[model samples]
Target: MTRPQHFGWFLARGFGPQGWGYPSLDWDYDWTRPEVYQEAARTLEQAGFDLVIIEDSPSLGSPETIDLRVRHAFGGPKHDPLLLAPYLFQATRHLGVVPTVNPAASLPYTSARQFATLHHLSGHRLGLNVVTDTGSARHFSDAPQLGHDEAYDRAEEWLDGIRSLWHSWDDGALVADRATDVYADGSRLRPVAHRGRHYAFDGPLNALPFTDGEPAIVSPGGSGRGLGFAGANSDVQLALAPLHEKSVRDYRARVHEAAVAKGRRPEDITILFAIQPVITSSSEEADRIVAASARPDDAALQQIARKQSSDLETDLTALDLDRPLDLSIFGAHVSRGSIQRLIGDRGEDAPLRAHLTALARAGRLSDRTGFVGTADEFADLVEELGDWGNDGVLLWGDFHPVTLHRTLDELVPILRRRGLLRREYADGGLQANLRSF
Candidate 1:
């Protein structure tokens, strides 16, 4: 029998325009309103998902690239996901809502208080998807931008400071003695005075102690320092890698090694790989979709260019497709990983058209853990991951009802029948739900 695995939904587009550039936009639900997302949150909880992780980029890129970021509604004009978490909590009973938060954007004290209040309000189902994107430093009062490793170093300090505040209220701090009308014991509160390299704060956090646990910590970093940060601090590691068994096992092993180095057990962190699978009705239909993608026409290639341009924060559509891309066109702030993903197996010398075409190509479900498949075929991959000692998977897409149903309607029952997806949530909050498996 296969052990059950956890499941989550990733709001890949963040709190930006939903259903944009898709046929579903015709559904006529206002993206700015709370009702659409609330309905989707309810649907996810009913589907037995453990959490929903929201992705955010606090800045619209530097002044030079703002147009590329939002022209196609790919990157910016995002309302804070942190602000949307409450509405999601109001709509669902058990689903955890994790919003992306950058350490540089807000003060540690402010983040701690706000997150603590939400964690308590949501019955401990809140999570913080901590990110270390230095690109948004300019928006935060000209915060000092650090190098890659140094950013992680600062994040470590930032997280430590937050945790210090969370623990400032001791276990017995809340006495709640009705007989004497004493709500809390002041003596039990510890005065936290932290002076770190990255941040300094004094706190006996005004928020009360968490009865269940502090808000869950989620991290998405794949670098060596990134993995180390996840191992030392994260409760859930938002992972990205190939879905093949060996690759999955290797990635898990690296996280485990890092955890052991930090004197933590491997099981302390749940590693959830991000996947965007194309679910089809039949194998033949899946085959047809894959075949059509092998040679994308001009229109399809241009569509791909728009997305790539948004992600790279550089315009690819304006470039001559026949000529090789000049690496110098990308600004210093562009993510190296985003650039590498755009230029996959092909070298930098390859023409821009070749690179885009490679990205446009699609693979079959039977092709080495490929994603294009029927529901049963997709279940096979999920079961295989469970057998490989995998923790879980996060399905990536928009946070709209249409998008959720399109993916989960056919896939959920198949997974549950195979004992791969959870059928019910446990009593504790999100952390409890993750650990219940």
Candidate 2:
């Protein structure tokens, strides 16, 4: 309970219409070039953001599907975020670095050791976004099939083994008691023998006690089984519902309530939602950007969004505004909670074409569907989303570095003017910055 902070938020870009996503899925990636991404990371940290997260997927969609497109792997030869985030720590000073890792790629023992080292190397500024890849097992070089919830079932053992290893190096355990000549107290470190339904691991990870300020866990479980697992252990309960402040608020409150029922403090977990922000000098300019994005010929919204449509004949941009929406043409199966959210509001009698177009419109234009407007209005949404229960919102941009700079150059100043966001950082490390609240 170090941070009594009323609000907390982080910025990130992955799965946007831009590089990390579209190109990863085998589209053009002119927006997210290497230098642009580096600059984007630099700018977000410089803007005094609490943290910036980078994510990964060994195989985006299901790797086993006969169709290569089914895996939905974004970007060609995508880099590893686990390896990428750590490299940024020394380059940028304060921004908390979190990387999403596919646990199935590396066992818990190895993952824990690496992250524990990251916590130490980064001055306790490391964070984790845990995603159990049950579906990815089929892609592995040497692993049997693990079902959906089955992956999460193994996560319990993974976490238990990982936590024990982190705690193995207890307080003052590594002291150089000169006269005592004790490098570490042998009695303090304990072995964790974990034999669970899905996994079995003996002893501790090959890492010293992360000592202090180990990476905080961000639990985001989208399914029913995942929820209970996440609710129990996450420092931040991360999830994205439809783009409604009310739903965002209610969902977060439910997560907090779930933690309370588990005999844990509600404030122990923070709710953070995904928000795509497009900022401009005025509302008109922002609107134009949204309009263009909503109609981007290259967006591939119907396909890129994991939507259930293929072989779309017409250019969605040519759609006339007067037509009714038909929701049936789009097949019943689509991924992400967002699809369900959009479909819930569909009219039964609506034309499938119109409904599909609107859904396409919503996905194509990042700013159009998100909190968009002038700096002031954008700030208002940030505050409102916060008031609704999210400690903070994750920012996704259409263009990598340019859009990030806009936030620093325009929106951040406005937020500072309103006395909402901090202009200067508080002294202390990650814990100190958060504890100041």
Candidate 3:
């Protein structure tokens, strides 16, 4: 029998936003309405996806150059992903809703209360994708920017404080006694006090107890400190390594080892490799599609430039694209991984203009890394990744509406027949469903 695997959609684009600076496709999606996201959630639920993560970055790039940011809408106008939770929860029964929350910016007490409240309201089907606010230093005016290691240090303490606040009220603390007029047992509640290196919180949370223990914690980071934070606290970790089998296996081993060292079982943590599948009727058609995506127009190049500038934390508009890449221009705050993934072995010595030209023409840096084939062939790829010990895959495709619809309607059936995907949800909430595997 084939082993079943978990599935999730990386809703980074807020459930298919229209005119979002991508090459022209077959469909136009209006993402401003919540119904679009609701429909997507329902479709995923029907397809037996494990969860849908809502990514949010509140601040646009540097104020000095906000025009490109607004024009591209990459970091500009973003609806708070948390606002869509209730809509999704009301629309679907089994699909888990995960909204990214930053620990460094938001207070631990507020996060603890909000997430716990969401857990109760959503019938114990909530997940928290925790993030450390390290980039965009201008956004956090109150505090100085922190190094990667220090950011994780603060996040560790922040998570601990949040957990303490969650436990302030015991499970059986609520007692609505009409005859005695006692709403809650006072003995079961206590204030949480923590004075850590980075955070200080003292509180018995002003909310009732959570229905399902606590929301499942999700983390996304590939750095050593990032893996450490995830291994210690996260129930699910997004593995964004190159989609090579050896690379994924090596990363999984590191995560498992870290969890084991922390006195936690390796199997208890789920690692989902992020992938974008280019599905078509045949291998030749898929190749044609991939080839087309590589030839982006002038408008497309501008969008890529804007997005790259944000990722590297430097304006690329000023760079002479035709000249050799000036490594000094990036300063000390550039995203090393982003640049490495782009140019590969060419490194910083490659021509700057050639890189942008290639990016605009190719559309994405990882065009070759993603699986490209028919639905059945793509299923084979998913199973192969499972063999490398991945819990499942986080789908991040730039799929057209028709393509996305077919993925749910056609591709999922293939996986179901192969016994690699679930036909129905297990009898429990998000945490139980996630840990079932």
Judged by lDDT, which candidate is best? 1
lDDT (tens digit, per residue) of candidate 3 on 216-320: 899988888888888899899998786677888999999998898788999878999887665677767776766776766656665667777766657777776
Pull out the clashing pairs in model 1.
none
Better of 1 and 3 by lDDT: 1
Q: State the lDDT of candidate 1 residue by residue for 256-302, as single tens digits.
A: 99999999999999999888889998999999988888899989999
Specify the highest-TM-score model's number: 1
Clashes of each: 0, 15, 3
TM-score result, candidate 1: 0.97
lDDT of 3 at 183: 97
Where is the poorest 10-residue window by lDDT in model 2? 1-10
After superposition, candidate 3 runs with Cα above 4 Å error: 15-30, 176-181, 291-303, 331-334, 353-369, 397-403
How accurate locally, in lDDT, is each candidate?
0.89, 0.58, 0.75
Ten contiguous residues minimizing lDDT sum, candidate 3: 360-369
Model 3 steric clash pairs: 294-361, 294-362, 321-353
Q: Arrange candidates by TM-score, highest first: which order?
A: 1, 3, 2
